[model samples]
Target: MVSGSNGDGVRVPSASFSRLSATNVLFGWTWPQLAVGGVGLVLLVIGGAAGFNLPVMLVGVLVMAYGLVRFQGLSLLAWTYVWFTWRSRLREGSNVWSSSPLETGRTVGVLGVWSQVEDRAQVVEGESVDVVGTPWRDACYLYDPDKRQATAVLTLKVEEWSLSTNARKRDRAMALNNLTMTLASTPGVVELKETSLLMPTSAPVPPDLDDPDMPSWARGDLAELWAMPEIATPLANVSWVSVSVNVDRLSTRSRNMDRLTERNRVGVLLGDIVQNVVAPALVECGGQHGSIRWCSVDELRDMIRCVSDPAHASSQRKVRRGEPTLSYCEESADGEYVTLESCVARSWWVTQWPDRPVPAGWTRDILQGDRMIALTHIWRPLSMAESEKDLANKQSSMLQRSRLADQKRLSRDERRERREQAQREAEQDANWPDTDHQGYITLFAPDKSRLDDLERGLRMETGKYHLTLNGLTGQQRKALATVLPLGV
Candidate 1:
């Protein structure tokens, strides 16, 4: 975190996560680019050694061009991977998933058996959050037999920070940073996911209109104000944090145990981590005392149901474990968005973060809007050895880049990156674990036209902070998986 006094002399804490790696693996080229360019160079050298054959040299030039050219921030080879992946999905019919309606003509409302995604061993594919077991009351986990990992979801109710004093904000930020450090030091924690779900809620109870002295005109106007659409659909934001532990990483003894025994072991370990590490750290970070708890089996099911089918989000309906969460999900005919039952959804990759330092709560404006949206941050912690190696590579890359450019001048982006790297170095010196994170934004609408309008407005709003949102086309389903509170 970067803490400093603002123009008003209020000390506020701000932060910017590291973007995609800019370090060069070789001569200012990433691994993929370097490999492609190296092959081309080899071809050119062979042609030169063979008396400069024109055809061979031409092929070499074309290969080099292919390596250097980029389209939509991806090279030709990278695009090829995307194309094949999408094509395979199409062939496998993975893009469209529909559940047959029951006798009552209603589809399942909670995730359950789906033969299409089920493997021979009955494991659900692609970030499925199906709960495999609830070892005890108020403690449950989503287990992946293949990965031998179990993830526990916890509901976190943090203290409100809006309009809080500067000291409180600073303290909150520091406490959060401390929690991060604690997580980094803890072993067997493979990933940490924080998700915020913003939904439209029913209007709150209005003041009693039975006043004896109230004039008719005043009462009429007050009733109209309270009945406004925005007021009726007030925004409600819910936050969830999921921690994934590698069962095998925790105990090798599980390798010889049966699946049930292994799951039980994982459950016990997860409970311990939540009670000892996560719960305490969250409490210290201004979270309400006793407000953090592991989701029971039913709560987890309902959470997934609500996220998958937002129309049911405000209904407070009970979701059974044996029903599918989504009824009918398919990519739009234009491939611009996805339709999940009644809601039209679109997702974006947060390609850029604000270059200028902003407060830790800078996202309030975007998140507190009337529209329903979900912003997810997935963090993968780096071990100390891995952190040192990355830092060394970044330093080397920057030094080489400077040498290649004019000594006295640097580009604006270069300067900003240099400054950011300096801060990272300081963080490392302070034993703060380096983390790689990806940000995703998913927006929901009742229809395609509304979704389009929301997208346009959000683009403008995010641009104010120099943020970049790249629409995830042809991959909406996969991108949506990351933003869901499933620890994807």
Candidate 2:
């Protein structure tokens, strides 16, 4: 259920499951547009034949043109209609869609699915569910008021992670962890796709050029000159590389500043715009010389900060009547305070790894200085110090869980060893040669009834017993033949 009550209020609700309308997808436009066009065609052909004026005739032509467009099934709009028509049939009275409802809850919710004609597997068809982060992702919606944290971590019951020993499980874990956290915290997520590993698709990368003239200045350093198109080129290749993040894992570090009022959001809107959004444009601008460089997220933000004038000098100011002076003022940092560098190092830390290995000094600061951003990006909003704390907490918890699980497994192994030892001892006792070589004995029942009675009597005396063959002596075989009576 989408949570109803919480103080910060609803920013968004977790998908529980998101339903997508077929009409919203490609070819969904078919019937709706066709219906309009069909009526319009009737009007046009009728009006033209009925002696309407040139303007009316032009309107008729436009209507018929729309009908042909519907017939062509070329454009996105027409494609939607074609899809709808393909799914819809005149078999019965009701129109039907091609795909069935996907199980979202106890009662399945209908979200249309499709791939393509040649697609035998029917892969990558349906609504796109983008799993992204918040504050960093700017993806929150005002829906679920109570945002649950820590308790609600995203977990995929994956097949055993059969990663090679050299693979970086930690980085992969961290990346997935934070990606999950962001998507979980921001409840507006539609779907989650992993690619490159990309989820939801393995389609070819789309072209990023919105305009041929739009210069790109991505990568390089975070200086005034780094991202300007006047100096660099290749701005056309810029597309925001989405970072993965885990929200609940990071929420322990999420700071709830009473400072997030309407006024705060307004101020944050401009500054955050520069830091989070606008800085990328610089790198995307590329240089005039056709050089392309990637900027670490920090470098982009820092360079923007370097060029930007400070909002105000940190000064002691009078507090309002009810408000505490400490709330608005910057004080001497105590031992509890943390530095930004430490925070970034930890926040960016993922459980996954680099197969070969990158150097230890791979902070965004250092990467930015080197004018390189990682192929992957992670977004978190806390000050570097807070992010670091969250990272530490996540690691500590994971380690503890690992230890506990290991301990439990160790106990099981010990129990199994004991069982084997007991079995071995029992086997030795049974197989040990009787010191007295006790007299051998054999007994047989003459009939099935007698045999059942013997078996029952043995069960009464013994808990569990192993069966063995009686010695096949020639006399024993002759007696068995005689026991058959008439058959013998």
Estimated TM-score for each candidate: 0.86, 0.18
Question: Best candidate, lDDT-wise?
Answer: 1
TM-score of model 2 (CA atoms): 0.18
Question: In angstroms, how far off is 220's CA in candidate 2?
Answer: 25
Q: Candidate 2, overall lDDT?
A: 0.27
Tens-digit lDDT track for model 1 on 1-488?
Answer: 67778666878788766545456585446678877877888899899999999899889988987775565446677777777877777787777887765523443432332333222112221212423332234456666566665677788776777866777777777776776666666768888888887876545778677897888888998899889867756768888888887776774443433645555556666666777887777776667886786776567667666766675766667775556666677876555688886788999888777878777777777786668888887777778777788888888988887787865788788887788789888888888878777788889998889988998888888888888777767778767766765544
Question: How would you encode candidate 2's per-residue C-alpha lDDT over 194-227 as one tens digit per residue?
Answer: 1111111112233344544545652223344534
Q: Which stretches in model 2 have alpha-carbon errors above 4 Å?
A: 1-32, 48-58, 66-488
